[model samples]
Target: MQSLLRWGTERGAKHSCLQVMQDNAPALRLYEKLGYKEVYSYWYRIRPMST
Candidate 1:
């Protein structure tokens, strides 16, 4: 992932980000260790549009 990101960054990407569910502990840890920081968070709720 780091290699991929570095390649993208070198190719002119300003930044890269990925979304993970709040319950994804392992992924969050890995991302943190790789220099990613929590820049924003969002919440979601879903329901059927029709019965």
Candidate 2:
């Protein structure tokens, strides 16, 4: 991700964002190690609609 961040920065990307499943431990650890912080949380839900 460091490399990607560098690429993005070089391409004029002021900030970079990524998406990862909440339960992905290794990915979380790697991001943290690379200085990425948890700015917020996300979730998805399903619902049935009936008329």
For model 2, how does the per-residue alpha-carbon lDDT over 1-51 read when each residue is reduced to its tens digit? 778898989999997777889899999999888878889888988787888
List where candidate 1 sits over 4 angstroms from the true fold.
Answer: 48-51
Give the 10-residue window scoring lowest on summed lDDT in candidate 1: 42-51
Residues 14-43, model 1: lDDT tens digits: 988989888999999999998888889988
Best by lDDT: 1
State the TM-score for model 1. 0.74
Model 2 reaches what TM-score against the true structure?
0.77
Estimate the TM-score of every prediction. Answer: 0.74, 0.77
Q: Evaluated with TM-score, which candidate comes out highest?
A: 2
Task: Report the poorest 10 consecutive residues by lDDT, candidate 2.
Answer: 13-22
lDDT of each: 0.90, 0.86
